[model samples]
Target: MSPLLRYPTVDELATRAAALVTRRPRDARLERVGTSRAGNPLLLLSVGHGSRHALVVAGPHANEPVGGGTVLRLAERALADPALTENADATLNLLLCLDPDGLRRNEGWLHGPYTLGRHFRHFFRPGFLEQPEWLPDGADAVTLPETRALLDLQDELRPLLQCSLHGVDVGGGFVELTHDLPGLPQRVAHTARRLGVPLELGPYDTLYWPSLGPAVYRIPPPRRGDLAAAITEAAVESTWFHPYRHGTVTAVVEAPMWGVRAVQDGSPCADPTAVLRTVSGTLRRDTQLLERISARIRPHVAAAPDAERLLAPVDDYLLVCPGLADTWDPDTDDGPHPLPPLGSAHLAALRISGRRLALRTAGLLHQLVTAAGSDPADALPELDRLLDAWCADYLDGCGARWIPVARQVEYQSRVVLDALALTARRADSLSGEPDWGSQAAVPMHRE
Candidate 1:
């Protein structure tokens, strides 16, 4: 088995990672980021002597294991190479796995071709009170200890080029989020090209405003109080009145991993090692540009007030444009764009439907396991009951306009359940301990 497959458990990962680092002890620093809600410690492996703040965090959602795998592989290789860490003017901080509690819910069976497919399913739940993204009055209500650790580290070592690595399946190929940094587009494009990574621009993708013919989606402006109508209202209002904001960018990049995978997937050579080589090459090509971008932002970093002022509008805009889905366009090479915000009705309907679908799937799986006399079925019925309420709350009265989004939501539901079933089966096989819903419901709390 590959080294990637060999490291399964968290202990195994830590042990193997530490030994790999020992091969070149002088360059990098290995330290704990913080403990998870479930008492698992988050880890960061640093590379580079220069403290010119650069951060790449992965596993924020827990189920998204690809990002974690990519970051860990980079860390391991960087530790081995040493040059990645000992660069003259920049420091690289790697937050390998951010949400350990969420991660452990599907532990032991976290990786592989099969696992990746399952992970893409059931990975998204709306941000709740405990989520890092759920900020109430500018303060997080349920700040997981892991979140606190990340924030504390950010305060202690303010990074200039930070990447909160995440993935989406909206067909936005290799999407990147950009703040209003000078020369950002060119630099991002250049880095992407060097790495053979493709770009799909956002604004044009949604405006249905392609370079060529009529718009792909030419629905007339939605009527007042309509979901689409409200969404358009919000999008236009934010663009005009609200401080024109940019989100997910503090000199950040939101590269869509699967889109890049598509490039390799279609190629004649589909070897994992070669594919990774392509990925590393693409990343390494951008090394100097990243360093330059970091250095260029230094004056802004040094003058903390200036950086804050620059980012303030962006912060304001992001607040107004809730539910900003990432966008991409193949023709323009512009990279990710913020999708028009969904109106409250549409958004609510989508969430409720998703929740119900998830719960129903879980309940059905629980029934299967229990009937087989393999696992306890305590929470299955509760899950089913909750599913009905959630469905009622979100999906009941919405008219036909939401059919498409609802369809997508339903698709997402099927995928999530399928993946969870796979995860459960894998868990059962791994541990002699019988599966039990009584084993604390996968702590999904919505505030």
Candidate 2:
């Protein structure tokens, strides 16, 4: 068994964080922000008694819990050494897990024996509109308890620095920053290399955004009446950095669960247009398949008590994805635009989409089975066969290659710690304060 498989559950992580704060009562304080939709306590661990503060948020997406481990390690480090933040008069505010309801849905594969097959089997990610961090309109429409809690915290703390930890399905890690801090991208790249994580250089789903380095990118602010805005209205990143008036330098670290050499190869392609056409075609097929499956199960699911809530997002996604595919223009540019090389990252992205669709389909089907009061054996055999076949195909297409969980945590923690150190050093330099020895150095790996 790999050491990466040895990760703590949400309950265990919360208990551990509470214990750390309890042990270092003088330097730390623990507070419950609010309860999740599922009634899990959302915990915040505040370390150091400094005037300036940095907010670290983890586990916003249920599928990407690597941030949870990273936050725990960071809180522990801050508690052990007060000089890490006290020297700069800064406090470390850690949110252990934001979307506990989603986290609980994914807890099936989080404990041990982490495999790609098992991971996707229990995977559940709410649609973008359904997520707690971002919604279609301003969070003013936000009904989720978790989102409300986060908004309240942002209003109260108004941190100087905010770090949202996120992970990818496969390929290399990347950094997204709100502000162009000097030397930060380089430091992030260096840290990733030292931790033996690849930096994805190929065209990702968000390739339209300009890149600062191999994998580092500057997140563009959402424009009104645009797709980005429509998709991420009042997102946490934009809210914290733009209108919040806190001068918060927000950073998002997206690390991967697996890596391959092809993710970094940016070689010119023979025919970029053909590649775009192929991708567009795949999307069209997937959209059609989802529509067919939804239609088949709709009558059954409609009678369930929570029918609309369970099916609306999936329907919206199905509608939007096909429309996006229809709008793809492969010949927009006169000059050659190289196709993004197909790599492990590409495969991983496809696999993730397939798994999500399957999960949604299964949910609808399960509702149908229950509403009809049919025997388990009498449920739709055709739907079951199709789902089983899709899962097998997804696994077969993307070969098994897992990155150790410890390495993933190390990369995330180092980037976060380095950001803190850099922010503190900038403050010290401005104030003409002497640098604190050793505490100012950013370690390649956490001690």
RMSD of each: 21.8, 4.4
Clashes of each: 6, 0
lDDT for every model? 0.38, 0.66
| TM-scores, all models, native as reference | 0.47, 0.82
In angstroms, give how far residue 270 of model 1 lies from its true place: 35
Judging by TM-score against the true structure, name the best candidate.
2
Question: How high is the lDDT of residue 211 in model 1?
Answer: 18
Q: For residues 113-219, could you state the per-residue lDDT of candidate 1 as single tens digits?
A: 33222332223322223334222323233355766687666666655445554433222222222222323344434444444343434212234221111101111
lDDT of 1 at 333: 26
Worst 10 residues of 1 by lDDT: 238-247
Q: After superposition, how far is residue 217 of candidate 2 from its true place, in Å?
A: 0.7
